[model samples]
Target: MSRKDRDHFNLLCDIGELAALVTGSHNIETFMDSAVRLVSRHLKADVCSIYLYDESAEELILRATIGLNPKAVGRIRMKPGEGLVGATFENLHPIRESAAGGNPLFKYFEEADEERFESFLAVPIQRGVQRIGVLVVQHETADYFSERDVMALKASASQLAGAVENARLLMDLYEATGTHPEVQAPASLQFIRGQSASEGIAQGPITFFKKSHVAFLSGDAHRNENFTVEDFHEAVRQTSRQLADLQSRLAERLPESASLIFTAHFMILKDPKFIDRIVHQIAEGVSPPEAVKNVARHYINVFASSSHAYIREKVSDMEDLAGRILKNLFRRGAEKQENEKGKIVVAAELYPSEILKMASEEVQGVILVKGGITSHVSILARSLKIPLVIADHPHLMHLPEETPVLLDANVGNIYIRPDQEILLQFAGQEAAGKIAAASPSTVCRITQTGDGTRVRLLANINLLSELSTAKELNAEGIGLYRTEFPFIIRPTFPSEEEQYLVYKHLFDEMADREVTIRTLDIAGDKALVYANATSGKNPDLGLRSIRFSLRNRPLFEQQLRAILRAGAEARHLRIMFPMISSLDEFRDARSVVDACVRDLKREDLPHHPGPSIGMMVEVPSVVEIMPALAREADFFSIGTNDFIQYTLAVDRTNEKVADYYRAYHPAVLRGLARVVRAAKTAGREIAVCGEMGHETAYIPFLLGIGIRILSVGPQFLPALRERIAGLTLAEAERHARLLLAEDTLAGALKVLETPTSG
Candidate 1:
């Protein structure tokens, strides 16, 4: 063979060997060192270096060096368009300069190294459209690293992006599950049907933030117990600062509820106990990172292996807490890549802490890997009205990290490798959903159906912010203004004066219309600032709703006093209590209301007397004792949301059985019929303020059941009122009765959706 052919073959052999070694290397430092060495030897270059893209900083970080100044290996960063390497990254193409000093892109270089090198060749490493970094090979002869050499290096760069992606996934999984060697993506695709919560369509790029575990601890991480006490403290300090910073950033961006998760996580990181453990690791002579990693690992292991199921289950949370600390300590933003303008974020699961960490404006929607209809994340998503889907296929985590992805939350679908056609289709669908939502704002008006029964179209308002929206939707009044949210989020019992302020504001805002204020109906398990002060227990049957307030007479009286004061401020103010199981709970609550009115009169407190008071026909006992309870109460507002769960004996929080708690169930409908009949007999009004009211499909059935006030979400009012205006109450009643007698909810809904002869 000719010498040229032999040289080319040898270079090819060297490339293969280098590729194998670099791809197989577990240690990043060693991988770069060996890679640079191969480039220096094969290309006969005086200098070789690999510049990796530091995604968080948006700069090219020097990863390795050979035949160059040793200091440059650890201390070189090139901004985009700053140096020859930067120019290559900036242009997204390769560049070659025969004279190193003549290029304007050249920055400070080693004089001795420059003397020995005259030619330069830089190849931009790209994986798809993203440039991973740059590979520069320099030689003294001024003709080093030819076009073929650039092609070869560019090929090598492809493998590097794959390796980096693998390494990152491994790191993420290792931080989250503590299982080394991350689970690989499936060769074939699969899908999981997620529960639908919010109704909308959205398409955006995905941003994944899986909880990471703090890997630093004081142990023989590298088979050496060589950390000191000073090192441990330093490591603790570093990680603590990171955690604190993360908490600060999240607090600034997240809503009040979201801040709690980060707050709890921040506290865990600052715990002196963990800090001491970290110190112990340092005392053992481990490096700072090793010390932190070891201590964290040990804590994580103990928690994971704990016999207490709660403790063991909390390991994931603990890992997330630790990760927050590390994230804060590291405190680098997700580096922006080319074409990051509008990308949706998809994840296995999202917690408030992580979700809060992201920029809301940048996030179009989120697809979670693990969350449920009742998950806090879902609740927050609903509150924000953001499009989201929870518990998608696990394979979603394996998609290209930080790459553009499309999430279609409307149909509980996510499209991977979505080309322009698919994305355009999604955009069109999403726009249609939005247009449909906005188009119906002025659609509602007062009109009678063929049945000649007038149905009051009202809004089920929970937050004070919904008053304007309620008016905009042309709701006649507030059928149910859930007043329990404040109690749930408050740190202590809200004073009568504080309660009065809010109630008065709402009543005044809706002065021209009616407003039914449901008393504090806190369920157990949801964090309540005061009352019963228990750590953790089943709260469903615990002190909550009417039972909770009645037992605490003072609190109930205080709330009643506030309602009375607010009632005086408006012409139409209605008061209601939730979770009444029998006539006794109803009578007792009524007596309290009567007493509050009399006491207010005695105190010369100006208040409205004789405002309509009501009970929530939610519990089964209330349904059974409806007639007597209805006589004692002025009216009945059926809270079908909780009623459905209680009737089914289902914990809505339980992922395994929550789907069974359907509101349209025949059993629930029967209960609703009982309440409606009892209210009618008592010459009182009946309003439904639950998911049943919000759903358009269930409206006909509800009207047929003799419900006059249809209280629904503020957003649903315009559409619902429009539907109601076109309905005949008599036909609705007949349809509802026919539907209720049916054996299945689907059959009942089908009857409702069936065309009625106008």
Candidate 2:
């Protein structure tokens, strides 16, 4: 082979070796040390070192080194732009010098004894836009490093970056939670890391949380196949009853959102395909546990292999239900444990119903070996304000029950076998104080801009419980009442009476205030299994919202009838259709409402004469035809969430391109401006009922654009009210005009960032 070929071959080998070493290395120290040694040897350098960035301190601290004083490893630190290392990290580029010692930027540490090194190469270790640290190599001979060496080192540095980050995060958790390095198991076998589901810090003794444990039987223990089938059906019935009872208990103690968890569970138990699979297995003479395990494993594998995060989370739900059925088959009632206050529950996984059952004022937090943020359990945990971390650490399953541990969900970390100092530090960090203080009642008064621009602040509610919170927050009315909750929380379509009761209760609570009831917005990412809605390849652009409602007219009419019946008792009720891509869809939906009203009148049913009709302007197609839609529709709501997504053609949920889904994009701003202008020209009421409404930075821009109604989460009411009370109409209009003139997202953001005139 040629000399160049040989060098290239060696470089490839070195990269492979480095990857292996970094992957095999157990902890931060070992990983860093292995990296420096491997890089120095490959590049023929005398010294190699790594400096990790400390975000809180805004400094780079020396973590690992070769040919330097060992004592200086943790002692040396440099501020950004202070030395060669800092400059490389801050600039996010590589620095190479043949005469390193004489450079003014080179700061020599006396402890390192590195004055002899004349050539220096430093490169930043980065993960995307985030700069993690700097990697450096020095040679005793001047001009020793070459372009080939730089490329090789950069490749090696990239491999080490993620490992280094994981180590740093683990160390930070140890320090914060007081977990001693010595007590931790081998780095390769101990740490379980997962995404943060909820935010908060919690410390308490660990309790292995499980509803039941069953032993597997070989060949069904030779039990009769007919009996096994009967046993399976009986277990299914019992599991159904258990779920219903749990759902009732949860409904009494938690919000309807929490109780909805069992709804999914109930559906799984009644799923004919799932039950048939189990029955088929039982017919083959296997025990119920084996049948459940077999069927669950198949579904779990299918779901886990799905590319969508939402589908993958279903594995947890399926496994939870399978376990419930298995437990019932074993005739194992709910396992009871002694009352333990402030215990952190640890389990392989937790379902929403399980979380609700365990939720108590005394319960401290939760740790799961496997779960995703989209899981119903995670949603419940967030709603209940419980600290939860999902760590798939290998040691988790082996930890002794009741082992003292610290869980910090804020950063998705758990410290096993914590020390006294860690406990003391945790005690000093008051978790309760982190919660936002309730806005004072004085802020509950009517909100207007400084220049007397009356802006209606309303609440976007999905559950009846939120109505009370909305009232407490002094929301003027319900701007966006998502009506899909009742449908989503049932095994089958909710009856008109069931729907009527829910709507009646909401109307009774809001009393005279205007309540805008949005028809079922399902399909796409929010597909409901009970509704038999199957999400297509391009769900965002497929059957969703009004399209789904129109196709399933019976379901749609049922909801319309319930809404109309409830409107009879309501002083002011508005019915809105979601995802109206064109004028025809809106007119069609309005016609359905008209037909429902006529049907009610023919039956001598007392109903409201008529309700204001509106449609959500979310699709770009609708944006283009808003003038026509505004003329026909009674009002318009800008669903900014989907509007921006559809306009930009970006799926906000995909983390890969999430940064590109900018709400402040110039196109998005122009779109909003065009819609608002059209609504105003047509003399129609327009409101924004999306995440943008609650974002404080967007408030001034929104107000400036002539948007008079803003609907946000109930919790955001106080802060939004306070924000509106500080803005003036004139200044907002000026800011809006300035924002519209901008041609880029950055420029638009700058306009919003600037203080608006009060």
Candidate 3:
């Protein structure tokens, strides 16, 4: 390697070593202090600082520092485009300035005492697409930082990203666990809201995630007789063989899981502190088992202490590796650990794969202290049928472990140490829930009100795993099949053939049932990592859903072709366009579907020729032109989720506006009534296909508006059927009339909250 390459390699190794030590600090305060000093010394810089991004405040707060005013650490904050450091974070790129104050964006923080430094360099610490923080280094001499310095620093920042994330997660956990002494638990019944990631109701004892690495505890490392270095090498080889076997086994079950997951474990084995340290100790007359245990325990502490819940999860990996080696030393089999199973898992945050592992272990539900609502983990939780909610209230962490908890993920309410009244209420509802869950095969698929009015019930499916549940619930058909999930979770846009295989499986499963395939609805909250170039300040109002499809016509055409070929022999197929704000957008989308059919015919491909093309009435503008749209569109589906958001001019996912994003808003109810009326007059079939369909509180209102069709998540189909069975069309109409008569939200809510006389 060249001298520069050699230097870069050495710097990265030093960073990894430093991070390992920082991980064992066990708290963010000590982790930060140790981290900045180590980084400054390793890079041979005058100053090293870390600025962690506070997402809620949208500012980068100086978390730790060396060679600057220490008091300014938490006080100095910068927005994404405010200063030099902010520019690097916003652009996800490196910024190096020879004269720091010369840059126009340079805003001096008097408390930081950075004016003395003429050489400044900064880089964004990013893991994949998520920006964790920014790393900055400065020197006292003009033009002191070389291009090599910039490259080396950037590489170091990238290497430290994982460690930084872990420390941050640990910090979040600590704050939640009552690190602040003054914050006390409420004496009375308390309730708080968070973003609901998955929809379900679960009541279980809360189990805080800890001690996952205790499976093979090394009780006080001690010496043994006749243990040598040769035995240690043999144990290493045996562990590799075991990992190989495990890789093969998992590849059969989940091919994607086979990718690079074991790379970290293998790296640990080759790490100098791992095999080398044990071998050195063994050579110094320590027993082979003793040396291995000591080394493994060290790493376990390093991983479990200050590590993020995601990284902390790997403490088990370290223990498992060491356990495999120790088992080889004693010739024993692996042990199983299911401590968190059958309980609600409480953690700061977890990776997507960890969520899968929890599901495999039969975890009843999951509560996150902090995480995004539309993240991959959230999406996976929904697919796996795990109830998930993210409650950011720190008081949650201090609650007594193993206390009976009631989790209502449908609305993001958590009751800790639930009392008698709450328990009784949950029990009555659970009894009804049990009836809905048991003997699904015997439950009739047809839904009818007390007045004998038929309301067609369909499933909204995303994952193939949901197909069986949909079938068991006896869904008449699929109302909205979100195709974006396959695209969002993947590395790139799936080709026509790849999409063909997926859609083909769905068609084969639901052969004779109606399947409405919605085209790629992405670029908003559900963004593709590969397409981060489309990131915007306001994602909801930006180019998303149908706009994204029309902009990328070739890709859209590719997806349409796949859907057509997949459903060639299907009895019923419908193509729906989402986020259709105007009539022109619908026409443009329908034309592409037509073109795909023409090309398939010309190429002699087996493709469905005439699937009903429909548009989602999600955008508020669609309501004003619903009459015009109804004349041309084959069917209409009122997506109440986005409809309420747009009608009230509120962001659906914004926690601050969550109260305003309500289904019972007076304007929202009137809009729904208008759309249903338009569809009825046009003689077009319409369905309430959003959460409103499954929400029993809003079901009567939806039915009252003359919606005879309802579709929701498959898991909800059974409960929804049970709810509709108790309501009559006449009662719903009366309820709707009473609700429409109210002008204010409070008045409308009162009318909707009135208990129905079954």
Per-model TM-score on C-alpha atoms = 0.59, 0.60, 0.59
lDDT, candidate 3, 1-758, per-residue tens: 36565455336544225425442453456667777887788678899999988765788889899989999988999899889989999997788999999999998999998889999999888654457789999999888877667656765675566556655543333233312244445655357677688978888887765422332354432233465577678767666655544444433433222222344455465444456678888888777887887877776676677423444555766775676676566542223333456788887767565665465456889888876564557767898778999988777766666767788898898877778999899789879978965734567768899878999999888677788879877999889888876665333344454466568878998998999988887755576644444657887788788887788776688789989988988999999999899999899999999999998787555789899999888888887899999989999898887888788897765566666677888888998999999999999999988878888898888888899989888878877888888999989999999999999989998998899855
Q: Write the per-residue lDDT of candidate 1 for residues 419-527, one digit (tens) a residue.
A: 7898788778778877986764344456345455677778776556567777876788888876765454332344454466568768888899988888887664344
Report lDDT (Cα) of residue 99, candidate 1.
Answer: 85
List the candidate 2 regions with Cα displacement exceeding 4 Å: 1-245, 253-322, 325-441
User: Which regions of candidate 3 are displaced past 4 Å?
Assistant: 1-344, 349-354, 360-362, 370-380, 395-442, 523-525, 755-757
Best by lDDT: 3
Clashes of each: 45, 4, 1
- Look at candidate 3 and tell me the lDDT of residue 751: 96
Best by TM-score: 2
Candidate 1 C-alpha error for residue 467, in Å: 3.6
Tell me the whole-model lDDT of each prediction, alpha carbons only.
Answer: 0.63, 0.72, 0.74
Question: Candidate 3 clashing pairs?
Answer: 166-308
Per-residue error at 490 for model 3, in Å?
A: 3.1
lDDT (Cα, 0-100) at 246 in candidate 1:
45
Candidate 3 accuracy as TM-score: 0.59
| CA lDDT for candidate 1 | 0.63
